[model samples]
Target: MKFWQRLFTAFLQRFHLMRFFGRNRSFKELHQSSYAQEISKNLSKRLLNASRTQTNDLLKQFDTHLTGLTEEQAHTQQMTVGLNEVTHEKPLTWWQHLWYCYRNPFNILLSLLALIAFFTDDLTGSTIISVMVILSTLLRYWQEAKSNQAADALKAMVSNTATVLRHQVSAEDLELMHERYGIDTKNQTTHQFEIPIQYLVPGDVILLSAGDMIPADCRILSAKDLFVSQAAMTGESMPVEKFPLQKNLEETSALELDNIVFMGTNIVSGSAQAVVLSTGIQTYFGALAHQCYGY
Candidate 1:
């Protein structure tokens, strides 16, 4: 019986068995490798706040070296760049195509054979094979369409634009906090310096609430009746409580990060903003998706 089971399994794989079984025997990825694990693990790193002096120094460097903006007024202008564009497309490799071609090559070949056999009036083995070939073509096309739809949905999550603060006060300004926390040294004044959505990297904090897709991976800084669904990364069935990152970390017995959702997790119930810890393919879902697709 075991030998027959093995033989049947081989037969199904050889003839693109999953296609024949319809949805019964779908190809599922079981695991991911360490290389992919590393991509997900070191997803985000926070940049240390530059002191007012450091911000001034960095601003001067930016003006003199990168962009030639001499006026202090020019510094107030938004600085936005497409940092996450590199992870936009995952072009299929030649080997991936080769493997797919090998798996489904029979469909194309069968299509041709069916036409030939039909014309030649050769029904010996052609009848069943020809029907199988046509069915396989329909199945493959359907799968491709479904995959494209899922890809489009995933792209929609990150591609849509959102307002983000680009150059926030660097965390190093402790003394300045005693006086005026909002003063811009170069501007010689204080003003909200919100930049475009593109410049947002990991560790930048953003405010979020009901009906907002997370801009990046963030540990919950605070939550007001917060609830988040992490199905995109963890495949959890329901939304979990969103807790302050500090509280989540202190509970050593439980998964600290369990209640603390990452970037791309949807806020299901309440409202909160977290420090964006990861972005682009560095996101938990992004990294996991990368691994799953590679397999």
Candidate 2:
């Protein structure tokens, strides 16, 4: 019975019928599906409680430590969760924008009137109406195109890199380090490296300083006088202070948790180390971006 079930599932998947059956969705399809929003909500629930959990427990939940994840572990997680980058909706092409402008009801009515005038041999009226429609459509298209260009320019100004602690294990010296410390060598061999923010994965220990952007949703492992600006996420003009979780502090909202910081916020003062909790569309900022820009 199990064999037959597997065979039937394979058959449905092979012909791309699994989506109709609500099964066997590919990673991309799963994220793009209607259920994506629900999945993000579930993740949000989990992260909200993370600040109440102890530092050691939180690290254990993600299978990481203050020393950070091993290179192999990072790669595996990256494969499962995808790159830590927000995806924007594709902008309309020039022709598509022109078509959109021409599709306006007023423009359509004017076009129809121009055609009728031509058929009636009113050359002067037809020419004037045709010119009006062309000018209006062209003007709207140009304005929209220029606005898109400005948006693209602003997007380019966002930070694209982050500093993360990653463990490097050399097979040749692994045995020596383990023998000397009587512990795992991987956890003792972490080094801070600047990497592209898109390469970040959950469990990465991020290093933050004043003027640095928060690369992902993360829980503060430790901090010193850390002040972050939440103006990007919340309209609050004042910078909020953050610290490591000392006890199970209760909060009405995730943003109220002093131990957890969200993606896209900026650090205004001090330094800290944090572990990435979620990335890409699973983040609070990412979900908002998805809603605004679409998948």
Candidate 3:
């Protein structure tokens, strides 16, 4: 692409960040604000506190089907809700990071002093300060960018992975998590895999088994001796047995409910079927991480 055209395209894409007083805010802030508006109503408030039956009813209320959301519905929700990821600070370009270092208060003062000394024909103070500021600016950018890149790479490499059930052909298909990766049968059936945890959306049925990680905050639909080790998140070393709530329990709280499993918790024994209610930073565990990190 031509330089000017590419520049114009970049400018327009970043136009939403334009603000008064020469300030800039990330485009992520706009998305977050939009998401906040989505959860302001009673619907979201009830989901966090409602019991299993009530939560299922809410899902049915949104759609007529009992087989979970159709592919179209899942896609729509994916676009509406976005990826299941913790919110990250938007990365700054190299120039922005360098400019940030250059604008440091002490460095700015030293730079001005250096300029004054230079014009006065005294080489010692100005020469030393100027060299220091330039080298420091370069070093600061290098350190900051390198650290940011390494953190991001490590985070991406090690983030928890999950398996989820999307709208599928049959019960048998749902049982085979790695549908595509597995060998084909004489039935001539093509296969696929349960999507990554990050791809999970509301209303998807998650098949849980022993040693499987709970991808998103979910409500138990049916369980068979489902004992989960929530120690990593809940700090309770003992495994907690989770089951479906017979009656709609409300006053206690979702976290206290035996029917709900959350992200970052693992299933220690038995298996269950669940529906994802929240994912990404909207999850309870994600919020806990954000708070622990002093967000």
Candidate 4:
């Protein structure tokens, strides 16, 4: 990087990394926070760069096992990484939605008609029109509020989650995760559980089966004839088969490797347990989405 580029890079990492040190930032709230598309790829490039190793060694780097993170760790990573969803314009309140419905020319004309009726000494006619306008406004507001609520809920739940194994999480991080996300920290045993896509962090051992969405950028650990549909990201209608990588197998980029599974792709056949390395806007599909949608 040139001097200016280096300076700008330092400036960003300072602000971006600071949020993890502060209160948990809302991915829902922060659109540019990840800047996975702009501030240079943080998580994706690491795994891509590290793909020169065997899958086994790759798992070691993330401190993951076949089982998954205890609930605490998953939730903690959720806080750090933000939710896995597209950033949208701030949602409208009930009144705001109502106002939007009423702003049209028809609504304005109707309201004016009601006012004219009132001033013309037609009390019954004015009352009817006023009632109609008020009722319509209330109904419009109710419908819009419900629609927005449903859409918001859907957005929060849209990210396809993954199954992961927990292992070797630190005491401080575990405790912090427990305190922040209310996980079951009492039991010392670490096992597997379903983890949402957005909360995924490096080193999570993710289990995959046929028909499951690959939640993050991952290195294949174990595979049983695993085939994935990369149509959304790669635009290939055919499902591509994959396997665990061995040492000395070189690839210029992680995406070029057969042992890697990317986000937004679906497993078409068999199963696997891969170590998650990159998620959210850090996945291959995320990068594509960022470029196409500018989200």
Question: Candidate 2 lDDT, tens digit per residue, 1-295?
Answer: 9999999999865543453566433334544556555755676577777877878888899999888887678778988999998886455667766887787689999999999999999999999999999999999988988898898899877547787776765674455435532345555444665567887889999999999999899999889999999877666799999989734455545666788898999999999999999999888778766654435
Q: TM-scores across all candidates? A: 0.45, 0.68, 0.62, 0.62
Q: How much does candidate 4 score in TM-score?
A: 0.62
lDDT of 3 by residue, 124-170 (tens): 98899999999999998889888988998998776454444444455
RMSD list, candidates in order? 11.7, 12.3, 10.0, 10.7
For model 3, give the RMSD to the true fold. Answer: 10.0
Candidate 2, residue 178: how far the Cα is off, in Å? 29
Q: Residue 64 deviation, candidate 4, in Å?
A: 3.6
In angstroms, how far off is 133's CA in candidate 3? 1.8
The C-alpha stretches of model 1 lying farther than 4 A from their native spots are 1-82, 85-159, 166-199, 248-255
Task: List the lowest-lDDT window of 10 residues for candidate 2.
Answer: 23-32
Q: Which of the two, 1 or 2, has more lDDT?
A: 2
Which digits, one per residue and each the tens of the lDDT, describe model 4 over residues 1-295? Answer: 5999778767645433332234533332233344434423554456555565665566566555566555566566667877655453355566656666665677688788878988998888888877877788888888878887899899776655566666656667556655753455656455554445556776677789999988777878789989998776555679988888634465544444677787777899999988777667656666556544445
Runs in model 2 deviating more than 4 A are: 1-44, 104-106, 124-128, 135-159, 169-190, 246-248, 291-295
C-alpha-based local distance difference test score of model 3:
0.66
Candidate lDDT values, in order: 0.49, 0.78, 0.66, 0.66
